[model samples]
Target: MKVFVFLTLLACGAFAQQGPQCKAPNGGGLQPVLEEFVALIPTDKVLELVLTAMTSDPETQAVMEFLSSSEFYQVVDLVQSQPAFKSLLEFACSDLYLDAAYYFNILAGIFGFPEVHNQTRAAARTAGFRGLLLDILELIPVDELKALLDQKLKSDYYLQVAFQKINSDEFGSIIEALQGDAAYNNMKNRLRGLGVDVDLIIDTISKIFKP
Candidate 1:
């Protein structure tokens, strides 16, 4: 009986040294449990709440402090060194995130897609084309925008369409009108008024129309 008790104690000590297993048959780790809890939340409301918090002084300050911390830099370095982190970084920097609110608003409109006078569209249109263009340009990085345009312009279909349009009678008439002495002079005057060098404008347009 004494020998049996000693062996049992030794086995228990070995088990403790090996570490006790976390045996939750239903839930696994803290991450999985937190993810499950978050899944229950209305994400739209949560997003709006988070945005509101970030805009507040306290929350922004807290975020700035954490971002400037050595701990945050260590985490960033670790994440960047991981191979899988590139994919996540790409996703985070993608158009999906840049236009997340736009996509969500579109999704919201789908419920009432058949209905007229969508407030969202109306509000956007009311902001005016130039204002909207500026807002969109502000959101996109200059290099990414340039690369996207270059790729699109390089496509066979896009080049074909552009060639066809430029060869059309309407395009011919537009070029003729723009190239006329009176029209060209008026254009130069207008450009000069807008602080552009008339000589520079003429030189640029001349190169564009040159064979």
Candidate 2:
């Protein structure tokens, strides 16, 4: 009996030394909580809340803080895995995020998406920043996005920058990863199909998205 007990103890010790099986730290186990937080806010209300938090909250000076935070993005990715969550993000952002694309600058630290920063823009290019605002361009208004695009068309510098971002340029491969989710997945084109006039905005994006 004593020998058996000793052997059991040794086995337990070995297992402990092997360490707890790592779960890959997906969202640090906080995706559900973040999903809940997003669910509570209505689609139209999301922008309002972000704007409010940005304007009123001392801890977070801007919605861009939440949008670009890698931690926050992690949470968003996990929640986005759920169809319901993805649906909400897509619908809400269509009316809000795209319209508010000019505010991306405040979140660039979190939005750089370096993984595909060096990659070339895909043919359809339906993904990777379609409607998703970059950290640099998110801060400006639609009007500015248009003006910048206009300036770049004339100079050529802005066009290259936009190309780089679409093809492969950032660390997180943010452009690529964003394509996996709602903002860049398919909605931008849908909006255009709905007659949103995105090209007009792209023309301006060149000027404002300044590298």
Candidate 3:
């Protein structure tokens, strides 16, 4: 009996030294658990919940009102009339911009995101300012004036320099105007009412994506 007890103790020590077996059971993994979780929530129900939340938010209403206001159009006009803005638009319509976008799409393709590459190519070619500006010109009766200004803007170096200088000096005035606008203030206050800590959200998102 003593010899049997000693042999049993020896076997137990050997098993402990060999370490725990970690073989997963057949058909057991994270895939089934994820499927089960997804099955618990219907897609339509999820959409309904998100839509309800957005519609109930006062900030959403405020944003809609601000978008429909005359002040918004005035602000757009002011920005578009600036020389720096026109320069930016000209750059957007250039081939160099398309080349940069093509490189970005290639990088996306390298990362196993072929859809992003395809969408980027489509958007860069069709949805850019070149096409949009042409469409707008066709709709309006300013084709001759637009052609004249386009020629002068492309050829006049001194005019471009003057506009760049004015843009640099008066950029702050844009912010000042927005700050004094009633619709802008109302939208800002409504967004503040959501009570979310913007900095905390940004920090958390940064940490999540940190390498």
Candidate 4:
């Protein structure tokens, strides 16, 4: 796993050297780099490696160490300092928030236990919080994101807290102001026009807000 992560980092470094403008459509895009990385290793092997590490305390500690190390920060700084990264970040920020909260669910699953959460948060602090976050904002497809989020939220306390916050009076007021009764009625009408059962949307929201 360490070898795999090291090689992956090396490959990313080499790829980033190509500068941001080489790929037109994505603008030095992450897709080709990710594809190349994926092609270099079999999925089964990768999964095996991940599972092995997850089962071994020493291996997990090694990973945690690497994550919080100065070397990792250097990599993060290099990535963030790149013009391509900045460009991609601007583009990502424009639409990223639509799905960004889903990642909290992912994190919550990984660090849901207080012991794990404290350890991970401490590591993140050592690694520099902003740098750690900016380094991992790559997007997944919406459907896949939703699926992962759904699975993670099943055992995620942080996600529950986040959802509760969204349902709280402060956030509710914001939501209400943004889409009050008239707007919701209009949305229901629009959905009905598109042959969608508006009740389904309402029911979903009702479940989300249920005490």
lDDT of 3 by residue, 102-210 (tens): 3223322332222111111111122322332233223332333334334544655543433343245243343344345565445335434544223333333233222
TM-score of 3: 0.26
Model 2 per-residue lDDT tens digits across residues 1-211: 2212111111111111122121112322112222232344343533544444445444334334444566556554453354443332232123111111112212322354211110001121121233322321243354543454455445554334323333443312332344455644354454354333455455443343334
Tell how far residue 87 is off in model 3, in angstroms: 0.9
Task: Report model 2's TM-score to 2 decimal places.
Answer: 0.23
- lDDT for each residue of candidate 1 in 85-159, tens digit (9 for 90 to 100): 233222212311211122222322332211111111111221222232233223334344334334544543433
User: Which runs of model 4 end up more than 4 angstroms from their true locations?
Assistant: 1-155, 181-184, 204-211
Work out the TM-score per prediction: 0.23, 0.23, 0.26, 0.26
Ranking by lDDT: 4, 2, 3, 1
Per-residue lDDT of candidate 4, residues 1-211 (tens digit): 2212112222222212122222323322222333443354344544444444435434344554554465544444443344433333232223211121122123223433111110101122123322222222222132443444455446655444444444456444433443333533443354354343334434432332233
lDDT of each: 0.32, 0.33, 0.32, 0.34
Off by over 4 Å in 2: 1-172, 180-183
Q: Pick by TM-score: which candidate is best? A: 3
Candidate numbers, best TM-score first, in rank order: 3, 4, 2, 1
Measured with C-alpha atoms, the lDDT of residue 144 in candidate 2 is: 42
Local distance difference test, candidate 2:
0.33
Q: Residue pairs in steric clash, candidate 1? A: none
Each prediction's Cα RMSD? 29.4, 22.3, 30.6, 22.3
Query: How many angstroms is residue 191 displaced in model 3 relative to the true structure, after the best TM-score fit?
Result: 8.8
Q: Output the worst ten-in-a-row residue range by lDDT, candidate 3.
A: 115-124
As a TM-score, model 1 comes out at 0.23
